[model samples]
Target chain A: MENNINDDNAPKTCEYDPNVNQDELIKAQEKQIAEEIKANTAMVGSLDGLSSLEEEYSNDPVYSSKVKTLLPKFSNVRRTRPDGNCFLRGFIFAYLEYCIHHRDELVRFKKYLESSKEELFEIGFPKFTTEDFHDMFMEVVSDLEGSGSIDRVEAVCNDAGTSDYLVVYLRLLISAHLQKNAEFFSFFIEGGRTVEEFCKQEVEPMYRECDHLHIVALTAAVGVGVRVMYLDRGEGDALVSHDFPEDKEPIIHLLYRPGHYDILYKA
Target chain B: MPMFTKLAHKTSTAAKSSGQTAAKTAAAAAAAKGNVTSPAGKHFLDNTRWQKRLQKELMSLLKEPPPGVTVDVDQAHTKLTEWVVHMEGAAGTLYEGEKFQLQFKFSPKYPFDSPEVIFVGENIPIHPHIYSNGHICLSILTEDWSPALSVQAICLSIISMLSSCKEKKRPPDNSYYVKTCSANPKKTKWWYHDDTV
Candidate 1:
């Protein structure tokens, strides 16, 4: 949908040209390298701060053990690395640590995450990940904000034949994880907040349609840090629940009802 | 267990002695009689490599039991392979004292895909979402499924499904449940859009 642009942003008007010359290819590679360096630097603070975050959770010995034990296995499932340098793994663990220390915020975020699992899963998992995913996630967020894609996602989930909850989960997770990027966060917010509002308004209406849906957000400094949600289509309203384990806060539970989707303190 | 071996030996010997047509007929007969391990069943059973792989994996699952569950193979039926399983939920929930039976039918592409699980027995409370046939509408058994997921994982998911139910209601229509479920068994196309508040 983008119009033809000059050399700065566009692909340099290659209508007549079939092949990319050496210089252009080199420039593309350089741009890629620059982006990688930026991502690496942003992740640097998380890599160094992981130990302290782990220690903070150690204060609650039992919960700490549970988190420590479960986090690694979850990370292993989420890991896509053959050479051990995995962004999802490190990112999830860092987030979990954030949740452990900042109990109140963690609880609130966790509630939102749990309630939004079906939406998050579609946005954050299986289909989307790595480089291909980063772009797609940003695009969806932008589309939702600029083009009412948020309302559309919700409508799709609610309408006949559309995989509404799953789509919503995808958008929500993409939004939540993009916390690392302020612009992306804002874009995701426009989409995610709209979807959440729709859930509270339209989706919650028919009780029978809402059963068996649960949303859980999984946060580990390892693995594909995402919100996984399971929706049972066999029953009433889809019952949703989520799990949020972050670095700076104690995990919170976001429980939604007909009128309320609040973050319950889950220490 | 010994009968199982005898069936295998007998089937192989029959395969050697009989013509291809006879062998096929015998296998079909055994399967019709529900003697799945019988020589007749062997000839009629799916002979593809994928079927063998599925059988091996399903057997391993039968041998190792997960928590709060017991799986029993029905010795009576030979044509259809049936497992009658019972699961007890973790304490302090609606399902705590419940005992549910699940039936598994592994089609030709199982293990490489997923087996069909149906609820049997009076263990599960009838809910509007759950068909009387016990087929669930969960994603893991459908499009989101991967070969890495094992039979045990499916069983656990079912158990989890039982434990999560806050309400007890069967599908609004009882007659349609039995007749309508055979087609599109996974209900893969059905999307779960909303959750109970």
Candidate 2:
């Protein structure tokens, strides 16, 4: 039997006249854009059962060794769509899942969000638009009171309107955190751009990828620690781990590979 | 290659079909109610969220009209997608005394998508950036539109665009472009070459 699974079998590129093939080029570009939109809109898989991490890493020794280390700790990996908001989505799912089990924590989180709405308004978010997003966020969280299951949570996250609302609400929260604690965060900013400018340009915009600063602000805002396990090609037999809110124990575990993020679960 | 060809064909056909539907809807509305029908297609109106958002925005605009701008739906409350904005030219500008009615056509995406805005009434502004066909070449109305932007912001931008005009004259390629341009300006790939206008 031949091992053709990882073979490079793409068709060779053909040379074409730019002037004559202008329409064709545009058609190709449009198709690519359509495909990208389709990919982004596709339903994300939640709480994927990865019974054995060894199967995924069997081809690479470094990754296999790293998996072996994690095998004792975790059993399943929740896969989010590789859309730009993956980190935020993963965080929401993992945090909500935690909330489902911890009722007191859920109540506390809800109360925090309720009180934070006024803070968000004070931070300069328009009340009308902000209220819509805040209402949706409240609705989703409030629905998780008694009958919350992994399946129900997955359904909510997969729905585009609700998911986008949650993501935007998270972004607003992060922005508010940065704005509120400008003195501490100003040092983390690279350029001379003030915290407000940075928040407007980077944090507030939809689909803006979360950086370290965003992660820090989000964790601080929600008061929930996140543990991100880096899975990369970097020379490491050991999987790298970083905890947000440095001293606190992380409730959510995320697997980070370059630009993408997905939730991880302990056995 | 075949897939690409099919996709291109489908898109063009869809555009043509939508255009015909729009024409028919306009005719029907004129005959029945003497009001302008929504420019948004059936697919756009089908989304409940889009419809609700448009209504909310419409209410907000009506409650608090922006300075020098009066906004109202083109049709009755039933048609929420199309809006007619009457803008009084800001003081100290070339168009100070002039009044222009802007036709705003909102898609289902509402805030997510930029509204198709053009001057509809008589006496279109003779600015260098404003085409004779009522299509105003503005960046914020096109590529620079963000979901964060509201109808109020759009009105402000248009006011600013008109305010900054030094001379009242048609664009350089006004005649040729107007003759060859599509009915919908959104379809036209506008190259924003000049910021000075």
Candidate 3:
């Protein structure tokens, strides 16, 4: 067989010399730094005025100007931890905060969530663990049923185990959306990888950061419109905002500053 | 609520355990992992979520194991967190008759964190990716691991790895690696450079 011939000549043997030890040491040190960052930062911070952003960017004229321009449209920001789960964590925090004020939206979202477990199971996720995570998410959503307040939302979002479960479920939703619609998404996936592979490598793993594809999939999957305001050093006097589905009215607003995401409240 | 007594299972991959009879080695490895606390200080055997997940996986493995694989029944009762999975190289392949065993140790963070997996036997297969020290250089065991993968999936992958081998040869640096490598394979920073075994 041609395959056997190819394998005979090209024995892909993995080799690791002494120099490779540096990578392990570096990775361990990075983990140490990440732990320190986690210790110093809250998973989700309390809401604060936009002036904090202004002060953070005061030294850089470009960012300072961008922050000043953002003042009219956004009033405050609630920062999330810089760990890779920030986007997912921040998204749910902001959405639940909005749901607190808008009972109708909360009812609609809960209806969608209640039926998601079966769909995830259908998508071949491990039934037992997936169901466990789904149940945890359901419990959190159910918490907001009666007289839900922002303080209560904040408390639930900051609880370590509960909050992480919600993020994992959200990731599954995105993975499911991508796989279910693989025919269309297959065109967008580069590097010769299939939709299934992309989801396994990028979406299913915990602590893997979200990207534009992730944002697009999550918003489209849940039918929740998100508008992210970019405060990057990219040349701009005003902050640039991109809506998730191009033009759907955004229910939740987020601030994106390079590697991190935080919730934004309208003035 | 099942709290196993604390046991030192740090060197779970030691070849010495397998130098003894297979049945006794199984019990030795099982006894070593009686109780290991997770980073959160919760014992993995404390009927925690990880324990439940492991329990579910073990049940499935026992009920409908993959072909050429079976968990040592004696090890099943000793520890929920550690399992000694006996695997035979797939039939009609380069290693048709050879058998091997892998030790799986699950932390509380699994399936999010990969279970520490390594070959544990006197007859560590002579494969390019498997070192003499019983460390296996496989992507799925390390950086490429996803929570979705299970013990069955891993067994299939390792069997597939052996089944496809064109020749029997140890890794180029097998001796040097065995001398310097850590006991835990997960900590060794494996680079899965070759896929065309």
Candidate 4:
């Protein structure tokens, strides 16, 4: 008794024969899907009025009702590519956008970043590789100091290499933080993997999606909190919002729809 | 060469203003010295960060390479992007007394992306996870690649992979895979079946 067996949207598993040969075909299919997405979207998209979200869900009573509740609070949305790095990309875009308007926060963040590279090096991260990414962040920060414009931030965030490098350094910093406090993080690490293994497999690699641990570690590492508004098919009239690190107020707001994340601007 | 060029297009060039104005000249120099990165591939060479990373890796490898591994220095200097690595089977491994050459092709996205590595010489190993076409099914070479891991680390991993092998035979579907696989082994989403080797 499977529901909608022939439905295109049905949950598709790669368990079709568990065939090793089919991997190439799967890769090709994934490439095609990624290319289609690339052609249709931007890495970091421009803002859209909250009404756009409401219109998208107008046909669905539950989602529409839930979206209606959000419209009063969140004024606009900025989308990022649904690439697995969406969480970090959306987080950085929203956070940087906030920092642009608030210069003191930007300076404080820059100061923190200035010391973080040495910290990462001391933690045994290869200086040769890590330095380039650290320098890129510095370049962007100093560039923002000069320009102080949203267009500059948007362009940097949208540039594939620059944006991806920012995510990489953030990932490294998160990995370093989690490893430094492995005693506390060990309890949360799933699959019995040690902190280092988890960091290598999950946190250090590009294109791997972030999890609860990632968000927790990142928020703690950067000392910037994020508020993720969860939107889903759950039985609720309004979206549930949770702030990372629970105690600190979340300055960065994001809309989390299952696996993907996008920026949210409050009115 | 097609393999290198196809992936080269994805390398990072956004931050090339970092004093690598000599990239085109260097690329031309490389082409004259028999490097596979054609002068046509100069844009791939213009990535300063990528070049710096590769040059550093090359210097370190030449200074003190891992056991049983040696980089073709002249070839690497000719083109920092493509390199030839010589390997001798470890003293006690099943592959003892045999030799292999691996080609390491770096894209402009080095460190961020894994280098494309494959056995390039005639003596492609007859190992359960290795194909006749010289593609080795190692996870670290693909999805498991991390910027933290360097070229030396990959060589060490491959060395360890060979040292731990208990048998000498091609993968079960070696022929079928070699026939249908794309020119670039990186294009295949490899499903590592057995880790025990």
Candidate order by decreasing TM-score: 3, 4, 2, 1
Model 4 lDDT vs. the true structure?
0.76
Off by over 4 Å in 1: A1-267, B1-52, B59-64, B73-82, B122-124, B171-179, B187-189, B194-197
Better of 1 and 3 by lDDT: 3
TM-score of chain B of each: 0.59, 0.72, 0.74, 0.76
Model 3 over residues B70-164: C-alpha lDDT tens digits?
99867866987789999887878888888899999887666666788888878888888787877777767765566667887788778877887
Backbone steric clashes in candidate 4, count: 0
Q: Model 1, B1-197: lDDT tens per residue?
A: 00000000011132222222222222222222332342212322334533444455456566776778776645313423455667777577666766777767665434333566667677654554466666565545643343334567677766666666677766444454445333335432233333431
For all predictions, the C-alpha RMSD in Å is 25.8, 11.4, 12.2, 10.2
Tens-place lDDT digits, model 2, residues A165-244: 68878998999999999999999997676897688657765555688999999998899999999988777678889999
Q: Comparing to the true complex, what docking class would candidate 2 get?
A: incorrect
Select the stronger candidate by DockQ from 1 and 2: 2
Cα lDDT of model 4 by residue, A175-224, tens digit: 99999999999999887678987898788877777888999999999999
- The C-alpha lDDT values of all candidates are 0.38, 0.70, 0.73, 0.76
Candidate 2, position A36, lDDT: 53
Let me know the TM-score candidate 2 reaches against the reference structure.
0.73
Q: What would the TM-score be for candidate 1 when compared with the true structure?
A: 0.32
What total of clashing residue pairs does each candidate reach?
A: 90, 0, 0, 0
* lDDT of model 2 at position B137: 77
> What fraction of the true Cα-Cα contacts (under 8 Å, chains A to B) does candidate 4 also have?
0.18
- Please give the ranking of all candidate structures by lDDT, highest first, separated by commas: 4, 3, 2, 1
What local lDDT score does residue B45 receive in model 2, on the 0 to 100 scale? 22
